[model samples]
Target: MDEERPPVVLVPRGGAWGEAVAAAARQRGLDPVVVPLIADAPPEDPAALDAALARLAAGHEDSAEDADEDGVPDGRHGAPPTGRTRPDAAGPGAPWLVVTSATAVRVVAGRVPRLPAGVRVACVGAATARAARQAGWPVDLVPDDESAAGVAAALPSDAGPVLFPRSEIAATTLVDGLRARGIAVSEVVAYRTVGTGDEPVVLAPPPDAVLVTSGSVAQQVVRRMTPLDPRTHVACIGPSTADAARAAGLPVHVVARSRSAEALLDAVVETLHPNPRTGRSS
Candidate 1:
């Protein structure tokens, strides 16, 4: 009798995020099959984004000023940047910068190495938080709840102003939630999420589970691959992704408690590991 293979998981992501997910799956004793279904592109029109960043860098007549006594930039290095290294980022008048995705982090950091002085930073989830740290930025806030409502509820009610750099098609939950709380929000499109069309979701070796990272991924998974195996569990990263999966007509088997990779895997392990499969080859 041959040894049975471990359960397999299909991850619809590429690049570093995909690699990380694969590693996580391996550690969890599952086989990870990666398929790059989506890609990122710069926004078609960057005028609004440029203007907002320009304003953020304004009032900084002296760019030679050093970082604060603690060595953190005005916007703070432990979070997100406004772009170029401007000490004013830590200044009292700075806005609180909010980054919801890793792509947004890369876009903003490329322009404003440091956010205009005095700007604080908030990340939506652990993955995004890691990206912020990788950019050499300071992080002041990371909500316990990774959802927009969670972020809004966790933010300081008295937060003066917030600078939100997000994807072109990003949902307005965060903006709406913050505005409803009486906080001023400046929203800008940082990038566009595009379809890769790399390969139309072919499952050579049928997976026991599929991990959906975002609403876009959910849509793509359903569009490219449908009539999934009844035994295949579709795990969504969070409530929003789960909703998207269901709306796209894909049955959602599990929903992670939060929007992080760890949470997603936790749901997978708890749901699928009880009874492992034996070589689910399509």
Candidate 2:
């Protein structure tokens, strides 16, 4: 009998996102091994994050305090969020909370459940939006293009200052882009990325495909699992990650059209099967 196909593994660390990736791989008949190459760590200095969150929480409370007995908020509820604090606003001035990743949504929501009145939310993509919704946040903006540049381009230039909570190694694309547009962005480190520090992974049957989700994960993969089989396909979630993989001296087999697990797996499936209706090549 022919040898069984090797399993695929990905992400290194994604939490909920990782689970979604694994499920997608399974649907494609790619049993992926989940070996977290890195883990989430609290920032060494969380004072900045704490302060920002406190202000947001206060604003959330103040907004609630404005509601009448009929539950009609005297704030931006029935009305659209102006992205600026109204003179009679119940809460403190609100800022636009920008989230680019599902992880960011999880982290921020853990602190502030629902956003304060007048504080609009902008997520980069559908997955992140879903996460924010699950966390009880009202996502006000999701760019048609699901990338950092996309978010920066989509946000209104005349809007209020933006409160951006992100990972330690987050790229400067959004911040830089917004800044160049003369928009005020207050970036806070919500979490840190630390190596899981486990010894190099050893697999009897190496993964046929590897999913690279983030730049950090790409680095870890290179460090822990170098000397990959030439036949092993490396799939990146987006162009930025593909750039990182190439920088790390790892050959990238494919870059997903969009930034999602299903997209990544779809690209891999396409590579694996040239024929759409049939698994075999046409």
Candidate 3:
């Protein structure tokens, strides 16, 4: 008898990777099981975030500021103030907003109550885009790159100077790219990402493939699941993620073109299907 399809496991900790994986598996007639290994929450340190928001609102920087140097905020200030404190008045909607993460969406919404109706929004992935929509901002663009560079490339030509509230560890590529295109951009630290929990999650026999998107997620995975199953392959969502996976001592079987779950699934399918036309493996 022909063998049954092996169960495919989705390990999206939060946001939308798990759902994307499940959707892809279903499209391919594969049985998918969602096994969340981690989750995301607001930063535990409120005081730190409060301070960061204050700095962003005031446009005050102790050190010389550049977009590239903008990393995850330590949030030493208080919560984002309501009205006029926001940089530049775009007539209740002057600035276009570009956010790359789900957390950033929450930060922008909580801090800026009047997000200016004319301020359009753009993000890196479906999850971030969805988060923006939920925050009552109209999403203008969703990048195909999934990286900072991708988001930068996907920006609409008419998007005005953009306000980016993201992690302290965020890449400067987006900021630099936007600046090169003559788009004014602000890099604000909405929150900081520190390793929160620790405890290796051991699987029964290792999954067929493990998908990793962020450096922190990779670090956590390594710290938690170090003695990885020899048989399981690792698939990174993009170049950055692959770099992290390699650093963690895991061989990356595939690297998705963009940092999206759809790309990851495509990578997996290509790896598994090989070349049916050639009657040989890829």
The numbered model that scores best in lDDT is 1
After superposition on all C-alphas, the RMSD of every candidate to the true structure, in Å, is: 6.6, 5.3, 9.7
The residue ranges of model 2 lying beyond 4 angstroms of the native Cα positions read 1-3, 57-94, 274-282
- Clash counts for the predictions, in order: 32, 1, 14
Tens-place lDDT digits, model 3, residues 145-192: 677788887774434346777777776888999888766677766666
Model 3 clashing-pair count: 14
lDDT of 1 by residue, 141-241 (tens): 78988877778887765454677888988999999999887777889999988887845676766778899988888888887777787778899999888
Which lDDT values do the candidates have, in the order given? 0.76, 0.75, 0.62
* Candidates in descending lDDT order: 1, 2, 3
In model 2, the worst 10-residue window by lDDT is 85-94
Q: How accurate is candidate 1 locally (lDDT)?
A: 0.76
Q: How many clashing residue pairs, candidate 1? A: 32
How do all the candidates rank in terms of TM-score, highest first?
2, 1, 3
What's the lDDT for candidate 3?
0.62
